[model samples]
Target chain A: AQTVTQSQPEMSVQEAETVTLSCTYDTSESNYYLFWYKQPPSRQMILVIRQEAYKQQNATENRFSVNFQKAAKSFSLKISDSQLGDTAMYFCALGGGSNYKLTFGKGTLLTVNP
Target chain B: DAGVTQSPTHLIKTRGQHVTLRCSPISGHKSVSWYQQVLGQGPQFIFQYYEKEERGRGNFPDRFSARQFPNYSSELNVNALLLGDSALYLCASSPRASSYNEQFFGPGTRLTVL
Candidate 1:
């Protein structure tokens, strides 16, 4: 069974600043994938980033990036130059292999204040 | 191309009642996945279908079932609903069944059980 854990329940950051949301996961499968998804009040789940367990390099998308430490079973998302629009509930998920199901963490509510 | 779309943005049901949510995947995408997200928590995988075949099933009970159509659109049905079943049902679509494929999500359908 795969389990994901996000220790932080809530966090805050100022606009134009940076914030990192922590995530840790334990999985039996050697080949797995990690993901960060953001859900806004609109109730839409948006993909923020994804990282493959086999890859040593972190994944990045525009202002969003991940600090993926496979050895530590950690995958944290960093949003640089945070904007008000970035405020949302962020989730960490683990999947891959033949499991076909993604396990997600409880999530962290991130607020970007002006 | 249009993203994944779901019908009936919201619904209200009672115990013993049945409900069905619909979803249309992105053009050319053949995989559809369902999730249940309770308030203040992350989404839980329910099922995954690829090319109109059941690819995976989660820990959810038999009351929760889903199927994909020839066009790759899908429907999630929950029978004998319970208050614990009240949640946001999310639909995600990807081009392939592999986890390597990026899954695009839709605005979820909020189910309220009274």
Candidate 2:
């Protein structure tokens, strides 16, 4: 069984600042996918970014990027120019090669203050 | 294209009552997955179905069951629900059941068990 862990319970960032949320996973599979999802107060789970285990290049969206270290089994999300709308609970997830089911970590509540 | 959509945005149920949640996958998507998100925690995988066949299941018990229809829509049914079952039920869909494809999520159905 794969397990994702987000050590940070809560994180806060000022508007326009940068913040990083840490994540780590335990998996025996050599091929998998890592993802970061954001759930706002509206309860909508939005895909933020994704990283393929085979790819060394990290995934980056408009204001979201990831620091993926396959060797350490770590995948962290970085929010740049954070906005008030960015306030939400961030989750790290792992999906093994053959299974699309995702194992998620305890979320980190991120508050972006304007 | 339409994104994954779930029905009954919010529901309130009593303990021991059964509850049903619905989800419609995006057009052309053949895989549907269900997850449970308790308060202050990440979403936990429940079941995954592809082409109307059960592909994977998580650590959940038999009380949780789900099925995917021929049209690719899905329903999650919980029997003899407990207080711990009160949480957001999320549905996700992807083109196929593979780690290479990113799963698209729906606005979850919030289930409140009293």
| lDDT of every predicted structure (CA atoms) | 0.92, 0.90
Q: In candidate 1, what are the lDDT values of residues B1-114, reduced to their tens digit?
A: 788899999999989999999999999999999999998889899999999999999999999999999999999999999999999999999999966666889998999999
Off by over 4 Å in 1: none
Error of 1 at A23 (Å): 0.3
* Least accurate 10 contiguous residues by lDDT in model 2 chain A: A94-103
Report clash pairs, candidate 1. none
Residues A1-114, model 2: lDDT tens digits: 788999999999999999999999999888888989888888678888989899999889998999998889999999999999999999998987666689899999999998
List the DockQ of the predictions in order.
Answer: 0.78, 0.72
What is the RMSD, in Å, between candidate 2 and the native fold over all Cα? 1.3
lDDT of 2: 0.90
TM-score of chain A of each: 0.97, 0.96
Cα error of candidate 1 at position A87, Å: 0.5
TM-score of chain B of 1: 0.98
The docking quality of candidate 1, as DockQ, is 0.78
DockQ of 2: 0.72
